[model samples]
Target: MASRTFSEEDLSCPVCCDIFNNPVLLDCTHSICESCLQKVWRTNRARQCPVCRKRNSRDKYPLNLVLKNLCETFQQEIGQRERYCGLHISEFKLFCKDDNQLACLMCQDTRLHKNHNFSPINVAALKLKEELKIKLQPLQKKLDTLKLKDPMMELPNI
Candidate 1:
């Protein structure tokens, strides 16, 4: 089921629009953030929580593990999609052996790579990944050296 959430613009939730991290089930069964409940308690002396109509407890509320995991998974999927080729100006489908180019399904039938052997993008991507890994190694080593190097270098003037 899709999670119900308050609008971020509405200022109903500080962390997210819905699926509160530390959800406190009010007596009425409505859920709100534990922190939000505390804020409500500080402002109101009413015996019940405003949303759930439940009796207030002094102890801090426990975190909702299910909601936290859901949020994390959603965020990860979003991050993965943002890195996808569909969002890129260049579409990803066929790989040109000649130019090592990635093109959409349309580009393959066109004059762009008629003579070249076309391969699946995943295959080309594997080689490209190895190339990128090798290229990045030097930069990573330099970064590691910089991190370990002394801030102050002892030098005698030439």
Candidate 2:
């Protein structure tokens, strides 16, 4: 069986759209950042879930320990891989498509990428944006075709 790779976006909170910070699971089984939930509760003054709008009978939300740990690990990994090169300690301005890795000026001059295809990070980002747009087009059309029969209808399990 092939293993699935997960990105930070997959673990992000729906409310803040950031990697889960002190994640809490609601009665509706939706996970959200604790601070975001608190802010919602404070503003709404209700136990209603933000995503599903399901009312919670209990005030206390259980901490999603597994998700919290995963988010922490993800954040640490991202922090370790910031703009700087791992070996050269210089800013990464180029992305090597051959190795699917970011490279700094020093790293790009090395033999590892001598024959490899390289693009500036900004240009690579534009290409990725276009690719994402092409991928999302079909999904967007499918979403447009969907129609709701009832306002209170429960969402399907993810």
Candidate 3:
């Protein structure tokens, strides 16, 4: 049997369209981000999932920090997981800056490009890593230099 693959679009929350943070697995086994649930509860009396239509109480939308952190870790290891895509259940991708969305490559070259800036998976990953290295290298070098310098000879903290 052929194995399945997941894209960034799969792991994002439907309401906010962000990677799952504080994921809450409902009684019906449908998961929703705590923040999205909060938004619903804020503007609603009976908060229900937009997907499963399952009823949820306002107090139940507490953030699940543990699950949130876990997803973050996993997302780094694997950019996207087997979560469902909110927009296109059949297709997925990291994110499209041009369209301000996460969608399959086929969605590109569409009228969404009129006022959008679409980018690819590798572009975002590489750009972010490069930017971080550029910013962090100098700071790390400074820290090492300070550690090597004598405390008495160093200037006082301003």
Candidate 4:
């Protein structure tokens, strides 16, 4: 028997066109994101199923934990996969300056990104990470000072 392969579309919420977050199962046996259902309820002022238009007996939509778990797993896998170059089938290790996007070596040589100035993606990422650490240093110092002064003090919003 051949195993079936599923795409991100299969796990996406029809209303949001994104991976389901806080998915809920309707009485009509349809699953949708909980936030999408809330939007419909708020706009239409009715407890109707978004997919089937069936009048729901209860106002509250129970969380579809099984679907929610599947969506989360799918999203994580997608995030990891997105870092790879789709055309070159290689890891995106270069950042094209003209395009302001990451690309693989083969992608950089392609007509689309040819003649574009490039830098190592890892170097750019490391520089950005270091900058972020430097920027957060003041906040960390303030937090430490606040902790030493008063353990129960309310923090002032910067």
lDDT of each: 0.62, 0.85, 0.66, 0.82
What global local distance difference test value does model 2 have?
0.85
Among all windows of ten consecutive residues in candidate 2, which has the lowest summed lDDT? 144-153
Pairs with steric clashes in candidate 4: none
**Candidate 3 residue-wise lDDT, 1-158, digit = tens:** 12335556666777788889878766555667877777776887766777887876546644556557766765664544343354444345556665455656555545654556666666876777898999999999998888888675777878
- The best candidate in terms of lDDT: 2
lDDT (Cα, tens digit) per residue for candidate 2, span 30-131: 999989988888877667888898887777788999999888877776776687797997889999999988899888889988988899999999999999
**TM-score-superior candidate, 1 or 2:** 2
Candidate 4: stretches off by over 4 Å: 1-4, 43-46, 96-101, 108-119, 127-158
TM-score of each: 0.40, 0.51, 0.40, 0.61
* Candidate 4 whole-model C-alpha lDDT, 0 to 1: 0.82
Best by TM-score: 4
Q: Against the correct fold, how does model 1 do in TM-score?
A: 0.40
lDDT for residue 33 in candidate 3, whole number 0-100: 86
